[model samples]
Target chain A: MIWLERLLAISAKEARQLARDRVTFGMIIGVPVLQMLLFGYAINFDVRDVDAAMLDQSRTSLSRQLVGDLQATQVLRVVREAGSERELRELMQRGNARVGIVIAPDLERRLFEGNRPAVQLLVDGSQPALEKIAQGLGSMPLLKRAGTSATGVRRFEIRTEYNPARRTAVQIVPALIGTILTMTMVIFTSGASVRERERGNLELLITTPVTRGQLLAGKLLPYVIIGLIQTTLILGVGRVLFGVPMAGSFVDLYLGALVFIAASLSLGLFISTIALTQFQAFQMAFVTMLPSILLSGFMFPFEGMPAFAQAIAQVLPLTHCNEIIRGITLRGATLADMHVPLLKLVIFLVLMFSLAVTRFRKRLD
Target chain B: MTVAISARGLTRRFGAVTAVDGIDLDVPRAQIYGFLGPNGSGKSTTIRMLCGLLVPSGGTVNVLGHEVPREVETVRRKIGYMTQRFSLWDDLTVTENLDFMCRIYGLDGATRRARMKDRIRSYDLASHANQRAGTLSGGERQRLALAAATLQEPQLLLLDEPTSAVDPQNRRDCWENLFALVAAGTTILVSTHYMDEAERCHRLAILDHGRIAAEGEPKQLARDIDATVIEIECADLTAVRRVLVTVPAIRSVAQLGNRLHVLMHRDSADPERELRASLAGQCADARVERVGATLEDVFVAATQLRRPDVERAA
Candidate 1:
């Protein structure tokens, strides 16, 4: 009973202090909403309307039809017409166009002879995603459309699942839940211990009967509620604006989020014990945040990374959180299927909690 | 009398510097004990060690019959510490700070409510109960801090330079409150450099350079100082000071208004006569008379004028 009373006392104090801080209160809600909109609408992997230069070596109707067919795919637009291949190369070098299409002079003859390829598609290799899209044009059945008997040409069918429309917002919106939670929850308690020490409150606090566990738990309570609210805001905005389907149960998502939030706060508290000032705490938090954003499979493919980098990403909480959240939100996964990541999060929470408590000495040095 | 706090061979070092050297102390029950010293003289450090807020590098502390850094938890329940700085949450209101402290001390609902009301009224904080602690005046903040620290009514209270930021009137009022607390059978250990405040203590420890130079009642320490005091009234006090500095027996000389207060080695049989003999030819009009030693003289003898050679000879 006494422990509960002390815990409540510290929690109430922290809540009052946070309420009076206008900037922090505003940041709690403002950061999630702003980052959600910024990352959702601004990032697109399914590139379209790439500027292209065309070189027509032959004035036949067949060349015109070939150019029109490439445009019909909506992947490239003919912004410039080049008289020579060198001019098309210069156009790409000057950054005016990202793709180039050249129709050979003997296109009709080459189609009949079948000795060499009739059309050549040149793309700027600097943008790899655009290059992949431009290469897909090579597989189009141009001769078959021209009333020629098409011989043996290998064709493969590609189907994109979950996100059938290939909307970037769909992928980004669900994963934003994990990103936003990591950003806010890690920073919330990072400065807790340093701030108390800087304000001279630690001296008086340690003299009282409150234990370290009670103090840490009390400070973490309010921020957990704040994290849940931010989660709700992101989900609501994502559903209404982006039309991202809720394939999973809300209860399962929130449960996973609860474990992730606890783990992040424990890491923050551990950092708080290590930093001596608020500024240092913020810098250390940023150090963790940069890796969480870049290596958590948020913006990049996790498996495509080098072995060492993937190993680094495996240790980040957001890495597991991203998998769990994306699985539940887009793949409609149940908690039974998410036991591995959930167990990892629980282990991280315990490890960080013990580290923070052990590092936080009851007496000042 | 029961000892409220006792320490032996207490020492703390910060790398190359020793903040509190090997020291021994015992604070008795229900008395206002004071530590008088200048800045960097280990007053705050000593107070922190006594309250178990800081662990000593070497030595032992037994506070409230419980050994520190071992039984620190039990000792914490019986002690209240007010830091040199006002450490209450500045964003919280006066009432809120007291309420939080009350809850932390495990006071029941009825007792907490009653104590809050009582403290607000007694500390003259009823009018500004809702105002934030940061917005209060320095004096008001000190009062609020004191009120908050005493909410648990612990057996011992450790205050570190509590009145340094307060005005004279507020300082007096604070001392009155301290006396009241002492009368209620709560032992208080206060540290300050103010001589007037030190004089009010039942016992005083004069700290110097990480060591206790002298310890006793203020009046007793003054009477037992190792220097002879002689006041000389002269028209040209500066000239008198210049002449007195050349005398081998004189330890220190200070100008007080139009007179010169001279301290000579206690080995001099007649300090007043010796001072008059030394100034006879230079300025015969100087009036030399024996005077009683003050706390300032005691401080100078214990800290500034007591050289290594003099200490060895004594």
Candidate 2:
């Protein structure tokens, strides 16, 4: 009961202190909205309007038909025709085109001889995402369906489930809830704690009767509220403004997020215990944020990355939270379906809080 | 009177460096105790150990009859500590800072409110109650800090260089408040680098290189230093000092105002004659006279860098 009273006392004190810092409070509430808009509209991995050049050397009626086929997919728009192979290379080199369609010189004669002429799609190898998407367009359904129906055998039918439209915002906006919370939570909490240590408030607290557990818990409590508020703002904006669906129960999202936010708060506290100055704390927090954004499947699919990167992603709190958010919002995942990630977050919180308290000495040493 | 804090063979180390080594201390109740040392001499380290903010690398510490770092919780409940740097919540108002500390110390509602009102008046913080602590002037901030530290009526107060930032007027007022606390039967242990402040303590300890060089009343420390004080007047006191320090019998040389106050080995029976002869032999003209020792001389003599042979042995 005494520890609880002291916890409440320190929490109220921190809340009052943060309330007086108008700029910080404004940023805490404003950044998520700004970030949601920025990431939701701008981060589209579904590549479109790809610039394409046609090098139809044959110039025959059949080759003309193929050019129309590429354009019908709406992904690649043929913008130029190369006079020769050298000119086609020039189009790619001048940055005028990202994809090039090349047809053989004598396709009809080669077809009559029963030895098929070589046709190729040359693409810019730079920008791996653009390269992969452009290559996929070359093999789009327009080309495949026009070439063959192979009516002799039967192939199994495929069906897409949950996010059948493959909307990046549907996935990214929900994941942004985790990212915005991660950045703001680490920035607000660790920055505040390290500033106190630098300014001597932490030292003063150490001399008080408050235990380490109470002090850390109290210091992080205010930031947890800030994290929750930020999470809710991002989520609400994501659902209403961006049309990201909330397929699962709100209770599932809230309960999952509580554990996820605790993990982030504890991570920040661990960073504060190690950082001697506010600058160091800020640097450390951002360094942690980078991995969360890159490896959390927020920007890229987790399965698409290399196995080693997947291993690193497994340890990050943001990775699991990203999965939890996307699963609940996009897949209509229930609380039962999210136990693995929630359990991971809980385990991470326990370890991080323990390490933080153990590393945080009462002495200046 | 029962001692408020007592330590025996207390030691603290960082890697290979020993900060507080084999030091013993006894601070009595209802008295002002001063800790004096030069930079890196471990004054702050000792105060931290006594407050149970730091663990002794060896030996033991007992504050208010509780073993330190083990019964540190009990000690923390009874003692209030003010650090060398400003430690109050900078973004909070003056009243909010005091309220926070009172709650942290588990003060109940009525007592908290009454003491908060009393300190706000006595500490000259009534007009600045709603001002953010970061915007306050240096002196006003220290006043707020002291008011917050003492808001709970702690039994023993530990202050580490509490006046290092304030102007002279505020420093005087701050010491007046400290004396008032002592009058109310609160034990105070304060560390300071100022000689004037050191002279104000009832009992004091001079630390040098993590060891207690001397401990007693300031005047007693002055009287007990084993050195002959000789003041020299000359056109070039620097030149005279250079010649006098070359003599093995002369232990140290320090310039006070226009003259040099030289300390010689106590065994040197003819200190004045020895100093003048040494200066004259080097063809430096000077006048020498024996002078009574002061607390400044005691500090210099107690912390004098010992010869290499003696230092290594210790």
Candidate 3:
């Protein structure tokens, strides 16, 4: 019974202290919300709908069909139709299209004679991932058409400009920005609360009749809200300023951000509970954040990485967040489509949050 | 007759270091009990254990009749702890801090608000109710800490070095509030390093190296040592110790500023005769006078006996 009183005292004290401090409350709420707004809009992971211009030397039905197929894929939207290859190159240089497709003449003669036809694709390498995805999607229908012809007529050329090979930054920037916000919000709030404890203000709080559960919840709630705000901001900015598309539903993106926020906050709380000082908290948070970014597929493709990296990614909340965010934004996937990753995020939140609460309460005890 | 706080052989250890060794303590309702110890001598540890902030490694601690650790929550609610350092929310207004505390304690809306206001008024903080706690002076901050701790009207109040940094006037004022609480049937267990603060308690225990070296009414602990401390002023201190050390009754010799205090048992060392003889033989002019033993003397002797190595290490 006395133990209950003590818990109440501690909880009450924490609530009181937090309620009274406006800056801390702002830091808890405003920082995360601002970051969410910043990150949600500013960070985009999926490469979609690249603006394109085309040069068609053969104005035949075959050329039209090919152009139509390219447009049908939804990966490329033709911004301009060029009369000559020179004009197409000029358009590409003038930033008319990130990608340019050139179809050679005599394509109709080859089709009737049952001989091979030639085609060429040009892409700006400024963003390698988009260019790569564009090239892959650009070749799909032509390759399928050629496969149907048994007469050795399946030949095409794909030439990429700017970035000859897709670089990592095209895939990394959108997610890296979000992950950075997550790291900052979680570490800041967790360290702030723990610093108060180390300074012994926590004792003043415990003697006031607060429950550990209430205190922990109160401390975490503000950060969660803040994390959400950061997600919103990042997504908004990512879409508008950086041309990062939000192909997925806002709700789907939100759910993903929520899980990520909870996991990060809980991890932070866990660090705070175990640490003796703010420096220790910072060290632990950095340690957790570093591995999270490295193994979460933010810096590397999960598929390209070795099996060990894949397995490591499975255990990190960042891995699931990255997958959820990328899947939703890139594939326009619904929540149901992200069942496995969403489930993983849920389990991470529940387990990590429970453990953090247990450890934090135990410290008071 | 209510025993507001009780501990029997309460022991707490930090790994291999026993912060609070086996000890017994009891405080009747309305009594002020003080714990006196130097830094790291287990004063704060004992207070924490009593307030249910820390669980004892061995034995039982019953606060307000509730067993600790098991009923820590209950014990915690019943005790108000004002820690040695200022612990109020620096960014919050005084009223906000108090209200938040009340809310956490589950006090109802009207009651919580009214009690917070009353506390503010009582502590003479009404003018600063809207001022952030961080902006308050040290004395005001101390009052706020006290007010925040007492918000729940706890039956057992535990104050650990509550007045260490406060000015003399504020310290006296803080003590007055403590007395007021005691009169209202609150049992207070306070720990301090100040001799004057220790004297304010109804009963006190001097702890040294995690052990209770001496405990009782301050006057009684002083009387128990029963050493007639004589102040001797001499030009040559080495010659005085040579003559005084060999005396069978000279139990302790301590220096106080420029004067040397010779503590002698009543049976063997007569201060009047021995002082005159030593002065005539030493061939130096010196003045010696017997003085009643103060609590500081008793504390010094008890602490010395508990840790002889401290002196050797020094």
Candidate 4:
């Protein structure tokens, strides 16, 4: 009972202090809303409106029909017309167009023989994402669908699931839950201990009968609530503004988020123990935040990363949280289905909390 | 008298430099004991060691009958410590700060409210109870710090320079409050550089360069000073001081307004006649007389006499 009383004393004090700090209080609400708007609207992976240059040598009605079909796909727009092959190359070189379409001079004869290629597609190889779109353009049955009917065999059928429309907001909004929680939670608790030392409060506090465990636990209590509030805010905005679907239960999402919040807070407290000043604590928090954002599969595909990078990403709490959130919100997966990532989050919380408690000493020296 | 704190051969070293070197102390119970020294004389370090806020590199400390750093938890429950700086939460109100301290000390709700009310009344903080601590004046802040430290009615209070930032009027009021606490049978160990504050202590220790040069009752130490005190009044006190320093027996010279107070070795049988002889030609109208030693004279003799280079530099 006494231990609980002492722990609550510190927690109450911290909550009061946080309420008095205007900038920090503002950040609790402001950071989530601002970041939700920024990441949701700015990041787009559905590539469209690529500029292309066309060089039609046949001068026949069939070549004109091919151009119209390419435009109908909405992937490439013929922004410029070239007189010859050399002129098409110049358009790509000058950065005026990212894709080039060339029609053979004997297009009708080649189609009749079914031996030589009737059309050539030249794409700029500098931008990888745009180049992939251009490759997709090359495989479309433009000549066959344009009425020639040369090749009619279909090899395989592909289907898109979960987000069938493939909207980028749908992908980024759920991941924003992990990103926003990681940023705010880690930064809030990272400066707790260092701020006490800098302001000369640690000397007085340590001399009392309070234990190290009580101190750390009390400091982390308020920030945990703040993290949950931020998670709810992001989810609400994503659902209303971006039309992101939440197919899973809210209880399951909150349960997973609670563990991730504790893990991030423990990591901050661990940083607080090692850093000597508030500035140093902030710098160290940022260092951890960069990796969580970049390597946590929040912005890039996890499978696309190198082996060593994936190995490192496995250690970060954000990576597992992103998987858990995305699984629940988009795939309608239950906690039982994503037990692996949830278990990893609990392990991370235990490891970081133990390290923080061990590193923090009660004495000044 | 019973001993409240007993330290022996207390040593602390920070790499190559020793902050506190082999200090031996026994502070009596229910008395105002003081550590009188200049800045960096290890006053704060010794206080921290006693409270177990710092680990002594080499000695043993027994505070309030509990061994320190080993039985530190037992000691912490019985004693209250105030740091050199105002370490209370600046953003919290005075009442809130006291309430927090009370809860940390594990007082019940009824007892917590009673203690907060009593502290607010006694420390004259009723008017500022709702104001944030950061907005309080220096004197009010010091009073609040004292009230917070004593919220649990600790048996022994360790205060490190508790009145350094207050004005003289507030300082006198602070000492009066300390005396009141002592009257209530609480032992206080305070460290200070002010001579007047040191003189008020029942017992005192003079620390210099990480060592205790002298320790005893303030008046008793002054009575037993090893140097002879002489006061000289003249038209030009500076010229008399210049002439007096050349005398091999004189250890230190200090000017007090129009008079030059001189300390000579005790072996000088006729210090007054010797000083007159030294100042005969330069300031023949000077009056030289032997005087009783004050606490400042005792402090100077204890700390500055043995280090002649320091004396010369001064």
Top of the candidates by DockQ = 4
Global CA lDDT computed for model 1: 0.89
Per-residue accuracy of model 4 over A88-156 as CA lDDT, tens digit each: 999999999999999999888887776788888898899767876776676676677655555433455
Lowest summed lDDT across 10 adjacent residues in model 4 chain A is found at A149-158
Q: Report fnat for all candidates as fractions from 0 to 1.
A: 0.93, 0.88, 0.59, 0.95
After superposing candidate 2, which stretches have Cα over 4 Å from the reference?
Answer: A57-66, A104-120, A130-159, B228-292, B305-314
Query: How does residue A51 of candidate 2 score in lDDT?
Result: 92
Candidate 2: Cα lDDT at B217: 96
Measured on C-alpha atoms, candidate 3 has an lDDT of 0.75
**In candidate 4, which residue ranges exceed 4 Å CA deviation?**
A110-117, A149-153, B309-314
lDDT of 3 by residue, B1-314 (tens): 47887888888899899988898887778989989989999999888887777878998988888888788877776878888888777867888778767766677778888888888877889899899888998889989988988888988888888888789999999999999989988888899999999998999999988888888999988778746778888888778888887676666788877678876755654676777686678846777887878888888778864344355468
Name the runs in model 3 displaced over 4 angstroms: A1-181, A244-248, A362-365, B233-242, B245-248, B254-260, B269-271, B283-287, B305-314
**TM-scores vs. true structure, each candidate:** 0.97, 0.88, 0.76, 0.97
Better of 2 and 3 by TM-score: 2
Ten-residue stretch with the least lDDT total in model 3 chain B: B304-313
Q: What would the per-residue lDDT of candidate 2 be over residues B1-314, giving only the tens digit for each residue? A: 48999999999998999999999999999999999988788988899998877788999998999999899889888898998889887788899888889889888889989999999999999999999898999999989988988876878999999889999899899999999999999999999989989999999999999999889999898888878888988887667766865788777787878888888878877888777777886545688999988888888888874543277568
Give the C-alpha miss distance for residue A303 in model 1, angstroms: 0.7
Docking class of 4: high
DockQ (CA atoms), all models? 0.89, 0.65, 0.31, 0.90
Winning candidate number (lDDT): 4
